[model samples]
Target: MTAREQTEAYEDIPGTWVFDAQRARQGYHLNEFLYSLMKAANRAAFLANEAEYTRRFAMTEAQRTAVLRRDWNKLLELGGVSYALAKLAFTDGKSYQYMASRMTGMTEKEYVEMMLHGGRSPDGWRSRAERQGRA
Candidate 1:
């Protein structure tokens, strides 16, 4: 099927990405590298030579760059699943809040405050289709 055919658009729900089957297939190798972190030796080896580990996973250039740059949000945009990505964060001894804060362009305190306020307002956060409709 074509990309457009496989895609199903929905109303904007900020900071959410469904890890469906298509994403699962796309993320398999990346997830595999994250899961490998369950083993201390593998985790250590990866930290020692990130480029080598990335090459072993056969990650795309974009994915590899995201990994090297610690760009969690970009990794997700490139099809990395949240749960799978969590493993990478854990391997680095980082908390979920830290990762989420980074991904959302907020400090940990700001992220907490937003969550306490029931997340970001959706008032002006409509999807592209919605914006076009308004115009």
Candidate 2:
């Protein structure tokens, strides 16, 4: 079986690991967004036309080579999406919420809610909600 198939198969194995199906699905969706953005004509042209994208987000020569070879996990481990989005926002006036929505199939409002609720991090918004007796 392919690597992806093997990974999928592992999901069915009970007690194999701490599996979060929702998080896995979200990661998959985010990867798809990164792939599409990397290949999009408009985005490519925009990157090409905009000097700052290259100046800020383009990987180093070694990183570029690694990314070109589809080393996705490595790229992510090295701060791929986060780095790229931060650079894009800093140089292009885009917001992380907008970028996160674009990358994760979530709406901007949803992204904001998630951020506010600490859904994106370990310390979730539950505490704040609880403080307000909304939890």
- Highest lDDT against the true fold, candidate: 1
Q: What TM-score would every model get versus the actual structure?
A: 0.78, 0.32
* Candidate 2 minimal-lDDT segment of 10 residues: 14-23
In candidate 1 the C-alpha lDDT for residue 27 amounts to 76
lDDT of 1 by residue, 20-129 (tens): 67777887888887778788898888889988977888667888889888899888877798777887888788888888999989898999999899997766456654
Q: Highest TM-score: which candidate? A: 1
Report lDDT (CA) for all predictions: 0.78, 0.47
Off by more than 4 A, model 2: 1-48, 51-81, 118-135
